[model samples]
Target chain A: SQTIHQWPATLVQPVGSPLSLECTVEGTSNPNLYWYRQAAGRGLQLLFYSVGIGQISSEVPQNLSASRPQDRQFILSSKKLLLSDSGFYLCAWSPTGGEQYFGPGTRLTVT
Target chain B: AQTVTQSQPEMSVQEAETVTLSCTYDTSESDYYLFWYKQPPSRQMILVIRQEAYKQQNATENRFSVNFQKAAKSFSLKISDSQLGDAAMYFCAYTERSQGNLIFGKGTKLSVKP
Candidate 1:
């Protein structure tokens, strides 16, 4: 079975602080990885996706960036956080575009 | 560009009753896929159901089923005997036939009352 793991279930960060959220998948290799953000009571917006290592495709222009350092390791980062960056960040993986499997999201609160 | 629209922002249903959530999408491609995802208080994105646009038959799983009308671009979820555990935010998403990413709609929050 494939599973995704994300760290820092919840975080409180001050404005202009650096941020890093990591996601790792188990039992799969070369799978597609995606980063999404959901505002309070809103739908998820795709921020970035990677089909392979060092191949990140961004859907929406934002202050954040993504990197695939390994076959199953993906990281979402920001040099300086903004108040608008506060939201529920999700990490998902897919195999051959069938369906997406998500991890327990990171609830980021930027003050 | 593909876009998904979930018109209902909030919905409520009594326990053990049935409820249907509406979702519509726009896409120029003929072959694609539609999906519904559920997010509980835990904030885990759960795959509810999926329908391939090329398939004519509706897709069903246990108590959850999708009414897929490819011509109308309508895909709705019908939850039979809705349970309290079914309460959550439901999002409708669309993806191209070979695309690895999904385009999601503003979700609809479903509340199940006893």
Candidate 2:
């Protein structure tokens, strides 16, 4: 069985502060990783996705970025956060042409 | 571009009853996949069920079954003998054939009253 882990299940950051969220998958290799954000009571919006290491595809233009540093490790970062950046950030992994498996998720509050 | 729609924003059902959530999608591709994901207050997106476009038979997993209407471009989820734990926000999602990204709808909040 494969399990996905994300760090800092919840966080509160001041505007203009740096942000970093990590996601890793265990028991799977070379899986597709994705970054999504969901506003309160809203559907998820895909931010970024990576098919392989060092290859990230951004779905929407935003202040955040994602990196696939390793086969099972993915990182979402931002140099300076904005108030609008606050949301429920989620990390998901999927096998090639397979359904996605989501992590526990990180709730970010930009104050 | 593909678009998913869940008409009901919120619905409630009594425990031990049956409930069906409606979903419809717009896409030009013939081959793709549709999925229903449940998000509890805990905020984890759990895959409830999935249906492939090429299949005619409805996909069923225990008490959860999908009504896949290919001709109408509608995919609905039916929960049988609903339990209190079935209360959650149900989202309808669509993925392109051989593609990785999932396009999701606004989601419907299902409340199971005990």
Candidate 3:
């Protein structure tokens, strides 16, 4: 069975600080990875997705950026965080294009 | 572009009852996929059910099922014998077969009464 892991289950960062969130998948190779953010009581917003290493497509234009450094490792980063950047961040993986499985997620709070 | 819509912001059902959450999507392409995801209080997104556009039969997984009306562009999720554990925010999502990226709806919050 395949499983996804995310680091820093919860994070608190000061405004203008750097941000880094990591996601990794085990038991699967060459899987599609995605980064999503959900505001309080709102639905998810797709930030970025990668089909392969070094390849990334961004859906929303914001301060955040994503990278696929390895086949199963994905990283979401920002040089300077904004107050609007605080939200629940989710990492998801899909074998094909149909169903996606999500990780535990990271709750980021920018003060 | 493909778009998904979930009109209901919140819904509630008593335990052991059946509840249906409505979803509709707009797309120009014929080859696509629809999915329902559950987000609990923990905020973990879980796949509840999925429907393929080419398939006529509705998809069912255990106590959860989807009503896939391709022509109407409607895909609804039905929860049978609802349990307290079923309480969560449900989201409707659509993705093109070749696109691979998913477009999600606003989501509906479901509450199960004990």
Off by over 4 Å in 2: none
lDDT of 2 by residue, B27-114 (tens): 9999898999999999999999989899999999999999999999999999999999999999999998678799999999999999
RMSD of each: 0.9, 0.7, 0.7
TM-score each candidate. Answer: 0.97, 0.99, 0.98
Question: What digit string (tens of lDDT, one per residue) describes model 1 on residues A1-111?
Answer: 898999989999999999999999999899999999999988888899999999999899989999999999999999999999999999999988767889999999999
Chain B TM-score for all candidates, comma-separated: 0.98, 0.98, 0.98
lDDT for each residue of candidate 1 in B1-114, tens digit (9 for 90 to 100): 888999999999999999999999998999888899998889899999998888999999899999998889999999999999999999999988688689899999999999
DockQ for the candidates, in order = 0.78, 0.77, 0.87
What is candidate 1's DockQ? 0.78
Prediction-by-prediction clash tally? 0, 0, 0
lDDT of 1 at B6: 94
For candidate 2, the chain B TM-score comes to 0.98
Q: Write model 2 residue lDDT over A1-111, tens digit each, in one string.
A: 999999899999999999999999999899999999999999999999999999999889989988998999999999999999999999999897557999999999999
Clashing pairs in 3: none
**Model 1, total clashes:** 0
Error of 2 at B39 (Å): 0.3
**What ranking of all candidate models by DockQ puts the best one first?**
3, 1, 2
